[model samples]
Target: MLLKSIRYSLDELIYLLNQLSDKGYSKSCESLGNETIGEHTRHIIEMFQCLENSYDLGILNYGNRERNDQIETEIEFAKQCVVEIRTGLKSENKILYLEHVIGGLAIRIQSSYYRELLYNLENCIHHQTLIKVAVLKFQNIAVIENSGIADSTSEYRN
Candidate 1:
Protein backbone atom coordinates (compact mmCIF):
# COMPACT_ATOMS: atom_id res chain seq x y z
CA MET A 1 0.00 0.00 0.00
CA LEU A 2 2.83 2.41 0.86
CA LEU A 3 4.73 1.51 -2.25
CA LYS A 4 1.64 2.15 -4.33
CA SER A 5 1.31 5.60 -2.84
CA ILE A 6 4.97 6.39 -3.45
CA ARG A 7 4.74 5.21 -7.04
CA TYR A 8 1.64 7.28 -7.65
CA SER A 9 3.45 10.40 -6.40
CA LEU A 10 6.47 9.62 -8.53
CA ASP A 11 4.31 9.12 -11.61
CA GLU A 12 2.67 12.47 -11.03
CA LEU A 13 6.08 14.14 -10.83
CA ILE A 14 7.22 12.46 -14.03
CA TYR A 15 4.08 13.59 -15.80
CA LEU A 16 4.79 17.14 -14.69
CA LEU A 17 8.35 16.90 -15.93
CA ASN A 18 7.12 15.64 -19.29
CA GLN A 19 5.39 18.98 -19.76
CA LEU A 20 8.46 21.12 -19.09
CA SER A 21 11.50 22.18 -21.05
CA ASP A 22 14.98 22.18 -19.52
CA LYS A 23 14.83 25.94 -19.07
CA GLY A 24 11.41 25.76 -17.50
CA TYR A 25 12.44 22.86 -15.31
CA SER A 26 15.44 24.76 -13.98
CA LYS A 27 13.92 28.21 -13.74
CA SER A 28 13.83 29.58 -10.22
CA CYS A 29 10.39 30.18 -8.76
CA GLU A 30 9.72 33.50 -7.06
CA SER A 31 7.07 31.84 -4.93
CA LEU A 32 9.62 29.30 -3.68
CA GLY A 33 11.92 32.09 -2.49
CA ASN A 34 13.91 31.82 -5.73
CA GLU A 35 14.54 28.10 -5.52
CA THR A 36 14.28 26.33 -8.86
CA ILE A 37 12.00 23.37 -9.53
CA GLY A 38 15.08 21.34 -10.48
CA GLU A 39 16.57 21.94 -7.04
CA HIS A 40 13.46 20.59 -5.34
CA THR A 41 13.45 17.66 -7.75
CA ARG A 42 17.08 16.89 -6.92
CA HIS A 43 16.44 17.11 -3.19
CA ILE A 44 13.51 14.65 -3.44
CA ILE A 45 15.46 12.22 -5.60
CA GLU A 46 18.56 12.41 -3.41
CA MET A 47 16.64 11.54 -0.28
CA PHE A 48 15.34 8.35 -1.89
CA GLN A 49 18.79 7.68 -3.33
CA CYS A 50 20.27 8.01 0.13
CA LEU A 51 17.78 5.53 1.53
CA GLU A 52 18.41 3.09 -1.30
CA ASN A 53 22.18 3.41 -0.90
CA SER A 54 22.09 3.04 2.86
CA TYR A 55 19.72 0.06 2.92
CA ASP A 56 22.47 -2.48 2.29
CA LEU A 57 24.80 -0.81 4.76
CA GLY A 58 22.16 -0.96 7.49
CA ILE A 59 22.91 2.70 8.31
CA LEU A 60 21.12 5.69 6.84
CA ASN A 61 22.98 8.97 6.62
CA TYR A 62 21.10 11.65 4.74
CA GLY A 63 23.74 14.20 5.66
CA ASN A 64 26.10 12.37 3.33
CA ARG A 65 23.70 12.54 0.40
CA GLU A 66 25.13 13.65 -2.92
CA ARG A 67 24.12 17.06 -4.24
CA ASN A 68 24.35 16.50 -7.95
CA ASP A 69 23.94 19.68 -9.97
CA GLN A 70 23.22 17.67 -13.09
CA ILE A 71 20.15 16.23 -11.47
CA GLU A 72 18.97 19.80 -10.97
CA THR A 73 19.80 21.18 -14.41
CA GLU A 74 19.03 18.23 -16.66
CA ILE A 75 15.39 17.25 -16.91
CA GLU A 76 16.08 13.84 -18.51
CA PHE A 77 18.57 12.93 -15.79
CA ALA A 78 16.09 14.03 -13.17
CA LYS A 79 13.40 11.88 -14.79
CA GLN A 80 15.81 8.95 -14.92
CA CYS A 81 16.44 9.40 -11.20
CA VAL A 82 12.70 9.27 -10.44
CA VAL A 83 12.42 6.12 -12.55
CA GLU A 84 15.36 4.53 -10.76
CA ILE A 85 13.81 5.24 -7.40
CA ARG A 86 10.44 3.91 -8.54
CA THR A 87 12.02 0.64 -9.66
CA GLY A 88 14.59 0.31 -6.87
CA LEU A 89 12.18 0.45 -3.92
CA LYS A 90 11.63 -2.98 -2.33
CA SER A 91 8.67 -4.28 -0.32
CA GLU A 92 10.77 -6.04 2.32
CA ASN A 93 10.88 -4.17 5.60
CA LYS A 94 13.96 -4.40 7.79
CA ILE A 95 15.55 -2.93 10.88
CA LEU A 96 17.78 0.04 10.12
CA TYR A 97 19.83 2.69 11.91
CA LEU A 98 19.28 6.36 11.18
CA GLU A 99 22.48 8.31 11.71
CA HIS A 100 22.16 11.98 12.51
CA VAL A 101 25.16 14.20 12.94
CA ILE A 102 24.75 16.99 15.46
CA GLY A 103 27.53 19.19 16.85
CA GLY A 104 30.15 16.92 15.31
CA LEU A 105 28.66 13.85 16.99
CA ALA A 106 26.84 10.98 15.29
CA ILE A 107 23.58 9.90 16.92
CA ARG A 108 22.22 6.57 15.85
CA ILE A 109 18.52 5.85 16.21
CA GLN A 110 16.64 2.65 15.53
CA SER A 111 14.27 2.81 12.58
CA SER A 112 12.73 0.66 9.86
CA TYR A 113 13.07 0.86 6.10
CA TYR A 114 9.35 1.37 5.74
CA ARG A 115 9.38 4.27 8.15
CA GLU A 116 12.13 5.99 6.23
CA LEU A 117 10.27 5.39 3.00
CA LEU A 118 7.20 6.99 4.48
CA TYR A 119 9.30 10.02 5.40
CA ASN A 120 10.58 10.16 1.83
CA LEU A 121 7.03 9.92 0.51
CA GLU A 122 5.98 12.88 2.60
CA ASN A 123 9.09 14.73 1.53
CA CYS A 124 8.12 14.21 -2.10
CA ILE A 125 4.62 15.53 -1.49
CA HIS A 126 5.82 18.66 0.25
CA HIS A 127 8.35 19.45 -2.45
CA GLN A 128 5.88 18.67 -5.21
CA THR A 129 3.46 21.15 -3.69
CA LEU A 130 6.12 23.82 -4.04
CA ILE A 131 6.91 22.54 -7.51
CA LYS A 132 3.26 22.76 -8.44
CA VAL A 133 3.20 26.40 -7.47
CA ALA A 134 6.28 27.08 -9.57
CA VAL A 135 4.95 25.11 -12.51
CA LEU A 136 1.70 27.01 -12.30
CA LYS A 137 3.51 30.29 -12.93
CA PHE A 138 4.33 29.08 -16.40
CA GLN A 139 1.24 29.87 -18.47
CA ASN A 140 2.27 27.18 -20.95
CA ILE A 141 2.14 24.21 -18.59
CA ALA A 142 -1.23 22.66 -17.92
CA VAL A 143 -2.37 21.84 -14.40
CA ILE A 144 -1.07 18.56 -12.95
CA GLU A 145 -3.77 16.62 -11.12
CA ASN A 146 -2.93 15.59 -7.56
CA SER A 147 0.71 16.33 -8.17
CA GLY A 148 1.27 17.51 -4.63
CA ILE A 149 -1.67 16.46 -2.42
CA ALA A 150 -1.25 14.07 0.51
CA ASP A 151 -3.00 10.71 0.30
CA SER A 152 -4.94 11.04 3.56
CA THR A 153 -6.05 14.54 2.62
CA SER A 154 -7.20 13.35 -0.80
CA GLU A 155 -9.09 10.50 0.84
CA TYR A 156 -10.75 12.94 3.21
CA ARG A 157 -11.84 15.16 0.31
CA ASN A 158 -13.37 12.16 -1.46
Candidate 2:
Protein backbone atom coordinates (compact mmCIF):
# COMPACT_ATOMS: atom_id res chain seq x y z
CA MET A 1 0.00 0.00 0.00
CA LEU A 2 2.55 2.54 1.16
CA LEU A 3 5.10 1.27 -1.31
CA LYS A 4 2.76 2.02 -4.16
CA SER A 5 2.47 5.60 -3.05
CA ILE A 6 6.19 5.86 -2.59
CA ARG A 7 6.73 4.54 -6.08
CA TYR A 8 4.21 6.98 -7.46
CA SER A 9 5.97 9.84 -5.70
CA LEU A 10 9.28 8.74 -7.15
CA ASP A 11 7.73 8.36 -10.56
CA GLU A 12 6.62 11.95 -10.34
CA LEU A 13 10.22 12.93 -9.84
CA ILE A 14 11.32 10.79 -12.74
CA TYR A 15 8.85 12.52 -14.99
CA LEU A 16 10.10 15.89 -13.88
CA LEU A 17 13.65 14.84 -14.46
CA ASN A 18 12.81 13.96 -18.04
CA GLN A 19 12.04 17.60 -18.64
CA LEU A 20 14.93 19.09 -16.69
CA SER A 21 18.34 19.94 -18.09
CA ASP A 22 21.58 19.67 -16.16
CA LYS A 23 21.71 23.44 -15.86
CA GLY A 24 18.13 23.61 -14.69
CA TYR A 25 18.78 20.82 -12.26
CA SER A 26 21.58 22.74 -10.58
CA LYS A 27 20.42 26.28 -11.19
CA SER A 28 19.70 28.38 -8.14
CA CYS A 29 16.12 29.56 -7.75
CA GLU A 30 15.72 33.06 -6.48
CA SER A 31 12.17 32.22 -5.50
CA LEU A 32 13.40 29.44 -3.24
CA GLY A 33 15.92 31.57 -1.37
CA ASN A 34 18.62 30.87 -3.97
CA GLU A 35 18.44 27.15 -3.35
CA THR A 36 18.88 24.92 -6.38
CA ILE A 37 16.49 22.18 -7.41
CA GLY A 38 19.38 19.75 -7.39
CA GLU A 39 20.01 20.51 -3.75
CA HIS A 40 16.42 19.64 -2.83
CA THR A 41 16.54 16.55 -5.00
CA ARG A 42 19.77 15.50 -3.31
CA HIS A 43 18.09 15.95 0.05
CA ILE A 44 15.14 13.80 -0.97
CA ILE A 45 17.33 10.98 -2.26
CA GLU A 46 19.77 11.04 0.66
CA MET A 47 17.06 10.71 3.27
CA PHE A 48 15.86 7.49 1.68
CA GLN A 49 19.43 6.33 1.17
CA CYS A 50 20.13 6.86 4.86
CA LEU A 51 17.18 4.67 5.72
CA GLU A 52 18.10 1.88 3.31
CA ASN A 53 21.80 1.93 4.14
CA SER A 54 21.21 1.51 7.90
CA TYR A 55 18.34 -0.95 7.73
CA ASP A 56 20.57 -3.98 8.23
CA LEU A 57 21.86 -2.58 11.49
CA GLY A 58 18.30 -2.09 12.81
CA ILE A 59 19.27 1.50 13.44
CA LEU A 60 18.83 4.67 11.38
CA ASN A 61 20.59 7.98 11.54
CA TYR A 62 19.49 10.34 8.74
CA GLY A 63 22.15 12.87 9.62
CA ASN A 64 24.77 10.31 8.69
CA ARG A 65 23.92 10.42 4.97
CA GLU A 66 26.79 10.68 2.49
CA ARG A 67 25.62 14.00 1.03
CA ASN A 68 26.82 12.74 -2.31
CA ASP A 69 27.37 15.55 -4.78
CA GLN A 70 27.03 13.64 -8.03
CA ILE A 71 23.32 13.09 -7.56
CA GLU A 72 22.74 16.82 -7.30
CA THR A 73 25.06 18.14 -9.99
CA GLU A 74 24.07 15.91 -12.86
CA ILE A 75 20.50 15.51 -14.07
CA GLU A 76 21.17 12.08 -15.55
CA PHE A 77 22.74 10.93 -12.32
CA ALA A 78 19.81 12.28 -10.35
CA LYS A 79 17.40 10.34 -12.56
CA GLN A 80 19.43 7.20 -12.12
CA CYS A 81 19.50 7.69 -8.37
CA VAL A 82 15.73 8.05 -8.24
CA VAL A 83 15.29 4.87 -10.26
CA GLU A 84 17.70 3.08 -7.95
CA ILE A 85 15.73 4.23 -4.96
CA ARG A 86 12.54 2.89 -6.50
CA THR A 87 14.16 -0.42 -7.33
CA GLY A 88 15.79 -0.80 -3.94
CA LEU A 89 12.71 -0.01 -1.88
CA LYS A 90 11.56 -3.33 -0.59
CA SER A 91 11.63 -4.42 3.03
CA GLU A 92 9.43 -6.11 5.58
CA ASN A 93 8.35 -3.85 8.37
CA LYS A 94 10.31 -4.25 11.60
CA ILE A 95 11.16 -2.41 14.75
CA LEU A 96 14.06 0.00 14.29
CA TYR A 97 15.77 2.66 16.34
CA LEU A 98 15.98 6.22 15.00
CA GLU A 99 19.10 7.95 16.23
CA HIS A 100 19.43 11.70 15.91
CA VAL A 101 21.48 14.44 17.49
CA ILE A 102 19.52 17.52 18.37
CA GLY A 103 21.23 20.57 19.80
CA GLY A 104 24.24 18.62 21.04
CA LEU A 105 22.06 15.87 22.49
CA ALA A 106 21.81 12.46 20.89
CA ILE A 107 18.65 10.40 21.25
CA ARG A 108 17.21 7.17 19.98
CA ILE A 109 13.55 6.40 19.47
CA GLN A 110 11.87 3.13 18.66
CA SER A 111 10.29 3.24 15.23
CA SER A 112 9.10 0.75 12.67
CA TYR A 113 10.27 0.47 9.10
CA TYR A 114 6.83 1.29 7.78
CA ARG A 115 6.63 4.37 9.96
CA GLU A 116 9.96 5.59 8.70
CA LEU A 117 8.95 4.82 5.14
CA LEU A 118 5.87 6.93 5.61
CA TYR A 119 8.04 9.73 6.99
CA ASN A 120 10.28 9.51 3.95
CA LEU A 121 7.30 9.64 1.65
CA GLU A 122 6.06 12.75 3.39
CA ASN A 123 9.49 14.30 3.28
CA CYS A 124 9.76 13.59 -0.43
CA ILE A 125 6.46 15.23 -1.13
CA HIS A 126 7.39 18.30 0.92
CA HIS A 127 10.50 18.74 -1.17
CA GLN A 128 8.59 18.04 -4.35
CA THR A 129 6.26 20.92 -3.59
CA LEU A 130 9.24 23.22 -3.54
CA ILE A 131 10.64 21.58 -6.64
CA LYS A 132 7.39 22.16 -8.44
CA VAL A 133 7.63 25.85 -7.73
CA ALA A 134 11.19 26.03 -8.94
CA VAL A 135 10.37 24.08 -12.06
CA LEU A 136 7.58 26.44 -12.89
CA LYS A 137 9.53 29.57 -12.13
CA PHE A 138 12.77 28.49 -13.72
CA GLN A 139 11.58 27.07 -17.00
CA ASN A 140 7.87 27.80 -17.19
CA ILE A 141 7.13 24.13 -17.22
CA ALA A 142 3.84 22.53 -16.29
CA VAL A 143 4.34 19.95 -13.59
CA ILE A 144 2.12 16.92 -13.50
CA GLU A 145 -1.01 17.60 -11.54
CA ASN A 146 -0.81 16.55 -7.89
CA SER A 147 2.85 15.57 -8.27
CA GLY A 148 3.92 17.59 -5.27
CA ILE A 149 0.59 17.61 -3.44
CA ALA A 150 -0.33 15.45 -0.47
CA ASP A 151 -2.69 12.64 -1.36
CA SER A 152 -5.27 13.94 1.09
CA THR A 153 -4.99 17.43 -0.31
CA SER A 154 -5.39 16.16 -3.84
CA GLU A 155 -8.44 14.22 -2.73
CA TYR A 156 -9.84 17.23 -0.94
CA ARG A 157 -9.41 19.47 -3.96
CA ASN A 158 -11.23 17.03 -6.15
For candidate 2, the lDDT comes to 0.91
RMSD of each: 0.9, 1.2
User: Model 1 clash pairs?
Assistant: none
Q: Write the per-residue lDDT of candidate 2 for residues 78-110, one digit (tens) a residue.
A: 888899999998669988999999999999999
Determine which window of 10 residues in candidate 2 has minimal summed lDDT: 133-142
Candidate 2 runs further than 4 Å off: none
lDDT of each: 0.93, 0.91
Say which candidate scores most in TM-score. Answer: 1
Q: Say which candidate scores most in lDDT.
A: 1
**TM-score of each candidate structure, all chains considered together:** 0.97, 0.95
Candidate 1: minimum summed lDDT over ten consecutive residues — where?
138-147
Candidate 2 shows a clash count of 0
